[model samples]
Target: MFHIGYIRVPRSTWSVGRRFYSSEIQKKTIGFIGLGQMGYPMAQNLHKATKSTHRFIIYDNNAGATTKFTSSNSDTKAVSTPRDVAAESDIVFTMLPASAHVRAVYEGSDGVLEGVTPGVVCVDCSTIDVRTARDVAKNVEAKQAVMLDAPVSGGTPAAQNGTLTFMVGAPQSQFEGVKEFLQKMGKNVFYCGENGTGQAAKICNNMMLGICMVGASETFNLGLRLGLEPELLNKILNTSSGRSWSTDTYHLVPGLNPNVPASKDYEGGFGVSLMAKDLGLAVSAATEVKSSVMLGSAAEQMYKIIAGTEGYEKKDFSVVFRWLGGEKIGKGKGK
Candidate 1:
């Protein structure tokens, strides 16, 4: 029950309260670019979460993707370029593929900077190099815009389920301002210092992930070769100190882990090509800082081998197990 100017009002039956709340809300405009595998679902969730008065403007290099997305989401307007999307929005989100792609969209002639207002907040969710991320942020700042490097984790499934984890790097003043949007698309959001640290965190995490996955795959192959059952070896690894996400959650061996990319013939998960790219970024960063990432460098080379194999590049990074087992590697070469 609530009192309004000496009148008692039952809160549960107060229709005016709902009207008062709705009238006080301000509508926001959101822009999204790069409608790829992960980006598509992420944009979908953001739209679903704030469809009331928040507007969503979108753009993608692929015309078909923009058309399909707008067709389904009537409230979303598809635009010509990234700049146009930014022009019509107050907050812009980009989920591009690589550093080069991110640079193009944010720094090109008709880029986000050209269209965004001075105070527009731009968030990049691409897994790119720290150098590129910082460069982009600097450019955004030059235009008096705030930029946040917010790379995400979890595979396509987590993306679709709106449970991805975001590692964000932004100014202290701007982190809280953009966190509400991040929360719409992610289950966890970690603010990791300034400018390019988000890319740093993501690359470092992926580097260790590649190392662990490769090590686990090799260990599993060795255990099987030494006459231990695959399931038994996996159980031992999961229980012992050798346990990691590679061993327990996303195990490489088929029939050992269900509903994983390994079980689906290495489809719809983090690809070998992407893992190799992240490893290369790690190696490059290590070299820049004179840091000796011995195991990380070796893991980069291993992923490179897997990426070079035809039909293996698009498969899950865990397919290193298949390569180790000598199944589908080394084609058209004299052995």
Candidate 2:
């Protein structure tokens, strides 16, 4: 039985319900897939913020995630595949890795498009590309569903604190319809433009992030060699206009900020694999447009080194600067 802000729908017609609860709050009952580091907390925050009238349905390739998510909410249940998530909800959110995975999840016979439960909206928060995001949206509209490329900024902590910023590529009216639901999961929201612009914004932002992290690491290491304490140097740089979100919140100055990934042995945050993937998307986009991405190119290559040599497990990207100093920094996955 699906409950939406006290409104009950017949089980058989739930497939087409326009998020009864959320539609009133301008919200929606969301189905989620890919419960990794970001997704797990994201889904949890969404569930807890809403009234009990809202419900959740989930699916993941990993059984452990299914178990953990189910354990968190007794009423929440797991499904077998991506299609199941799409079939059961008013809207679906996907936080997958790349375009390939996104395609397979929706284009495959057993994927989301199979039975999207008409009037349903599918939002892909995964940081994919402009072209892929647009194409995926076309497929969604053809099935009489809506799609938005609402990729986010601010990683795991934001996901947990519900402070993430969403750059949404969606129509104005459509975006308005889903914003209430999205607001429950995040604090900042912007409707960037049509279909793929949100993803475009994401790639450009990450291209900057890649360069900033690398710059912070290089400068910090160089300053340390020049007799400055890593922590003190980081503090000065951050306060003196050289700071970025990485330098402030992420604070690559390991052991200084006990809360960031750097202090936790580079575990429990955005995975290196995801960074590599985002940089790769940046590189590909740069190539397609023949844009002068001097810094992005170098960062993409650096990510390759980190991914291949250090393993794409879960290291904070700040570790790349340490890798530059030749100490063979941390790995995302255990070696």
TM-score of each: 0.88, 0.89
TM-score of candidate 1 against the unseen true structure? 0.88
Off by over 4 Å in 2: 1-28, 310-314, 326-335
Instruction: Compose the digit string of candidate 2's lDDT tens values, residues 60-108.
Output: 8899999988997887879998888887777788888789989999998
Q: Could you tell me the lDDT of residue 235 within candidate 1?
A: 88
**Every candidate's CA RMSD:** 8.0, 5.0
Please, what is the whole-model Cα lDDT of each candidate in the order they appear?
Answer: 0.83, 0.79
Could you tell me how far off, in angstroms, the CA of residue 298 lies in candidate 1 after the best superposition? Answer: 0.9
Model 2 whole-model lDDT (C-alpha atoms): 0.79
lDDT of 1 at 14: 39
